[model samples]
Target: MATNFKIERRSAGGVRVLALDGYLDAHTAPLFESAIQEEAQAGNRRIAVDCTKLSYISSAGLGVFMSFIEELREAGGDIKLASIAPKVYQVFDVLGFPALFDMLETVEEAVAKFAEGPREG
Candidate 1:
């Protein structure tokens, strides 16, 4: 089946949150990328993607994150992942992106992290 996905962005406690729901595969990866770009364009530096509702994701989806990481970081912002499903976490772990993206267990935690300041790298 074709991957059906939708992205929603919101701001809470000075953090931008992207609620991603549905499969994130080759077909839907571009949508996710676009959402990230839109958020960045809006001056949303700190970003968290809520993946609790995300069902599936592929390498292409992961690539979108990779593509945006540098830009976000350069903007004094970062991208974080929260509420990720186990399967998706496994994928991130395998690719070592979980560490790179600051994967968190909850949206609240992500928000707090964002408030803590950017990663010191």
Candidate 2:
């Protein structure tokens, strides 16, 4: 069967949030990448990517995150992830993403982290 993916963008407590649902594979990774790019281009630097409904993710999906993180951080903002299901987290874990990025339990937590100030690199 063909996979499905969607991205919904919103702002919560002054931070931009991208909510993802469905499979995130090569076929659908561009959608996710575009969402992030638009947010950054608009200078909405602080972002929270909510993965609560994401059912699957391929390396291509993961690659999009890697592509934008530095650009966001350089702008004094960052992309934080939250509400990821176990399977997705495992994929991230195996790729050591948690070390290169921040992962929290909720979009609220991720947004709150941004308020705490830019992470000390």
Candidate 3:
């Protein structure tokens, strides 16, 4: 069965929250990329991607995050992750995403971190 990927976005204080559902593979990666690109291009820096409903992700999907994190940080913004399903998290964990990004327990927590401003760097 083909997985259905969906992205719903909203603003949370100073951050943008993108809630993703279903599988994110090569076919769906472009959708995710476009959403992130839209956010970055529009100058909305702080972002949180909530993955509570996501079931699977391909390397291509992971690549999308890799492609954006740096430029976002250089702009003094970041991409946080929250509400990740364990399966999805395992993929991120294997890739050492926790070290490179903030993975919070909840979307609200991720957004709150932004409220606190960027960490001392």
Candidate 4:
């Protein structure tokens, strides 16, 4: 497991904000996955991942997002990504996440998106 990874949970309006810090890879993906799982189980659907402090991400980390996106969407919730570093954004962009999820410039922007109503597409 990556000792450099950390996840901080908070709320922005009705949206749950998960602030990720450090590297997100195979060793750390499970921690992230579990956090989201707990949020979902609690009936909190509107989620925003604040990646401002996230320095890295691997395919495994990306997988954790994929694993829950559909379920969240189906339950009238969504995971919006925000404050991604340029390098980390590249990883998500390369995987076509830009089209599938809301990639915002700030955690506030992501939380605001939820107020606009459910995403389409």
Candidate 5:
């Protein structure tokens, strides 16, 4: 696992916020996955991934999102991503994440989105 990667958990307006810092590559993806898993197991459905400090990502990191999305949505929950740097956003965009998930400009926006209801796409 990457020593620099970190995940900070918090809450905002009933949304669970996971703030990611540092690289999100194969070596560190498991840590992120476990965090999400814990939230799901705890029945916290509305999640906002605050990526303001995320410096990098890889397919392994992205896979973690894909793995849980369906299970969460099936249970009436969703994960929203926010504050991604342009460089990292490009990877997600190219993979069609923008359509599959709600990508917002800030963590606040992502939390607010949950209030508006579940995502359509």
Candidate 6:
């Protein structure tokens, strides 16, 4: 069995912060999908995925976001990523994901950029 991951959500300065721990690969991506779906269903749209402890991510995990980005955006909400590991960042960079999403280097930075907050340079 794959290792279980942890998903923690809390309201941070008006945005929903989702902190993820462990790997986000084929078997574990569904757990993440369900979490995001549940949150969306509840009308909690402003999402931030804090991946400080996420060690790995497969293509299927990437697809979860690719498939939901539009839905989230249409609802006047957005997804932000923070604390990406270098390995994970390489995967995203190789796939041109830096152009596809708002990625931050730290959790503090993510909290500062709430949905309606000022853009960071």
Q: Tens digit of lDDT per residue, candidate 3, span 36-79?
A: 99999999989999988889998999999999998998899999
In candidate 4, the residue pairs with backbone N, CA or C atoms under 3 Å apart (3 or more residues apart, or in different chains) clash, namely none
Backbone N/Cα/C clashes per model: 0, 0, 0, 0, 0, 0
> Candidate 1 residues 2-118, lDDT tens each?
557888878888888999999898999988988888888988878988999999989999999999999999989999889998977889889888567788899999989987887
TM-score of model 4 (CA atoms):
0.97
Query: What's the lDDT for residue 77 in model 3?
Result: 92
How would you encode candidate 2's per-residue C-alpha lDDT over 1-121 as one tens digit per residue? 4548888889999999999999999999988998998899898999899999999998999999999999999999998999999989999999999988899999999999998998875
Tens-place lDDT per residue, model 5, 8-78, is: 99989999999999999989999999999999999998999999999999999999999999999999999
Model 1 scores a C-alpha lDDT of 0.88
Query: Which segments of candidate 3 are over 4 A away from where they belong?
Result: 1-3
Clashing pairs in 1: none
Global lDDT scores for all candidate models: 0.88, 0.92, 0.90, 0.94, 0.95, 0.84
Error of 3 at 106 (Å): 0.3
Worst 10 residues of 1 by lDDT: 1-10
Could you give candidate 4's per-residue lDDT for residues 43-118 as a string of tens digits? Answer: 9989999999999999999999999999999999999999999999999999899999999999999999999988
For candidate 3, list the clashing residue pairs, or say none.
none
For 1-121, candidate 6 gives per-residue lDDT tens digits of: 5466778988887778889998888888898899889989999878889999988888988988887778988787778899999998998899998887889998778777764543333
Question: Candidate 2 regions off by >4 Å?
Answer: 1-3
Count backbone overlaps in model 5: 0
Residue pairs in collision within model 6:
none
Mind sharing the TM-score for model 5?
Answer: 0.97
TM accuracy, model 6 = 0.89
